[model samples]
Target chain A: DTAVSQTPKYLVTQMGNDKSIKCEQNLGHDTMYWYKQDSKKFLKIMFSYNNKELIINETVPNRFSPKSPDKAHLNLHINSLELGDSAVYFCASSQDWGQQGTQYFGPGTRLLVL
Target chain B: QQQVKQSPQSLIVQKGGISIINCAYENTAFDYFPWYQQFPGKGPALLIAIRPDVSEKKEGRFTISFNKSAKQFSLHIMDSQPGDSATYFCAASGRTGANNLFFGTGTRLTVIP
Candidate 1:
């Protein structure tokens, strides 16, 4: 069984469009996160959710938003996609962000905006 | 702050040679350190991890060397082979229950035959 899974493995969209990526984890983890990996392969955290509650919000722009319908699912929606919005989006889950635990990651979704 | 720092953006090692990747963290609260491996077109997966209390941990060909006072840790892969070539990430996090990770810029390893 996949520990964590992400949908829309590859997304291609035009500028000014809106789209979303879906993620799910089967490990019964209480916390989930969204990370962005740029063209250069540098990964950065965008948002975090624990037990369906928003916990960590980085300096991401307003266009990027995360919604967790439940503890097992966290979805990301990007509004008015821009040229710089192209990157791989990764969904991860750990037992908690502060407590020590190994995070399980999903097969990232590669997004391209033109 | 980028809590975790990793060195040698990329590395190349010959077969049967030892491959080393180093990492450092500033927060003393980070009690768990883990190394993750990622193949091209895949998500990073946990390989092995160490707690601050242990100086070293070994599992098969992978080992973790940790120094609490220095707040430094490293991954050592012995008998590296082509199959072992991948992007490696070092991460740190500490919580009584949940999983929030502070990641380091990854290290790409190329094991040559």
Candidate 2:
């Protein structure tokens, strides 16, 4: 079974378009995170939710918003996407919010904004 | 600012050779360090990790050497095989309960048989 799964493996949209990526984890983890990997292969954390509570919010623009309905699901929504929004978005989950725990990541959702 | 710095953006090695990737961090608060391996079209997966208290850790052919005083760490693969060709990433995390992790750019390792 896929421990962590994401919807829309690929997303291609025009500028100013809005879209959402959904993530789900079956590992029964309490902490879920959203990361953005740029073309340079630099991974940066965007947001993190622990048990449906917002915990870490990076310097990402307000256009991106993350919603977690429960501990098992976390979704990212981007408003008025721009060219800079094009990148791979990854969802990860860990048993706890502690650094000692290892995070399990999903395949990833590639987004392209023309 | 790039908190973690990694060297040798790409590397090529022959079969049965050793592959080493180095990384250094500026944050002394970082207590946990981990190395992740990623294949094309896939997310990064944790291959090995080390804490500040440990100097070295080994799992199978993969090993992690950490230097607490220098605030640096390295990943060494023994007898590298073609199957091990992939992009490797080094990451560090500070504060015990925070889930935020600062990641290095990446290192693409190619093992030619």
**Alpha-carbon RMSD of each model:** 1.8, 1.1
> Which segments of candidate 2 are over 4 A away from where they belong?
none
TM-score of each: 0.93, 0.97
Cα miss at A110, model 2 (Å)? 0.6
* Model 1: fraction of the reference interface contacts it also forms: 0.75
True contacts kept of 2: 0.81
Q: Give model 1's TM-score versus the native structure.
A: 0.93
lDDT per residue for candidate 2 within B19-54, as digits (tens), equals: 999999999989889999999999999999999898
Clashes of each: 13, 0
**What's the true lDDT of residue B59 in model 1?**
100
The 0-to-1 C-alpha lDDT of every candidate, in the order given, reads 0.89, 0.92
Interface RMSD of each: 2.6, 1.6
